[model samples]
Target: MAASSIANPRSDTANQVWTDLSPLLQFNNMEIINVADGVTSFLIHPEITTTVGRLKHCTFMAVLWEIWCSRNRARFQGQDMSAKHIINRSMLSIRAITIAANFQKILQPWLVALCQSNSRNEILKVLIPKVVRWLTPPPGRLKMNVDGAFNMTSGEAGGGGILRDHKGNMCCAFAKPYHGLNSSLSTEALALRDDLSICCSKGVYEVLLETDSLNLLHIATR
Candidate 1:
């Protein structure tokens, strides 16, 4: 269908999607990850993430529910975002389904129903909490405790942690906004040292403390 577009642009704008421009058709080797039995999530290999993936793949997830509405303009009548409603009216479209399929094959009707397009402090108030909840592992699920902070341009900082069992569930969480002022040498050292202090205070005998700073690990251990 799209192949016919290059030669005949004005001739066919209805009934047939010009195959050539279809994102699915253009990106030949891209693979979609199966997240569940019926759901799919596709990540453009990192190499392409900065390009087409950023443009197309990212769009579908951003304001997924709202876009789902807009894409189905005829059915939805208009895109709507209402905080009080908890759920908005939307007409699903082929475009929306394709986008969902690109991300994960399992597009819950509820997710498609409540997803909104706005991304701001106000929206984050509504969105981030939900995302965090979704990302939170269930009870007894294995989870990692991670934290980060900035001290000097490259110096001492504070950190946080959370404990979880084998099921990706977070058993505990912790954080400290500011550790102290130090050089690059003491930044991570302070974080690790502080983490240890916290563990002792809370009586956490066994847990994982994760950090991205190599220098801190070295200093804290020594």
Candidate 2:
């Protein structure tokens, strides 16, 4: 009934979608008469801290998003996507989220079993987080680390950098705003150049530069 109200013109389609997806959810034998019933069940049924509950929440959220996307495509793009395609998309979306959140240990088995019959044998890749630490420069040297970013929509760019000594004490820092910058690499180079100018002004000649951008590093080396 709730699905019918929201998607009035496509109530029949919405009900069919709900009917197909209902078996996957654990509603504790309570009849889900409407969308509100399904939502209330999800909210109260699971203690989200638990692994099983988290998986269920993620699956439901992804499925809802896929459903909304399907609706929008049908209404605006004049496209009719199959329920199977929506279901598969939802699975892939949740699978990606689970792997990214490192829920492989807890939810991977469940996902594998649920999607075992999927035609495409998509591998759920687990992300291994790397430990990153800053190393101090040599005794007589100063280190400068710089970074830059740009917004594609507004065409705005900014760069910032910090200068640190051998003992890792902050010597100076600079942040600058720019306009009409085309790429992030150019911004990074500009930030590096600005920081280098600051070093020159302070007469700190012995310097080691560090940047996370490999392309900028290549440019600097050349």
What's the lDDT for all of these models?
0.41, 0.70
Q: Write the per-residue lDDT of candidate 1 for residues 1-222, one digit (tens) a residue.
A: 222222222322211221322333232211212222111223344333333344344333332343333335534545342322211222223334434444332233423333423321222122222111324445533444555666565354666666667565555666665645655445445556666666667676655555667766665469
What TM-score goes with each of the models? 0.34, 0.46
Cα error of candidate 1 at position 212, Å: 1.4
> Per-residue lDDT tens digits of candidate 2, residues 66-140?
777888888876878567777777776665665556553454456553453222345435332344579999897
Model 2 off-target regions past 4 Å? 1-124
Backbone clash total for model 2 is: 0
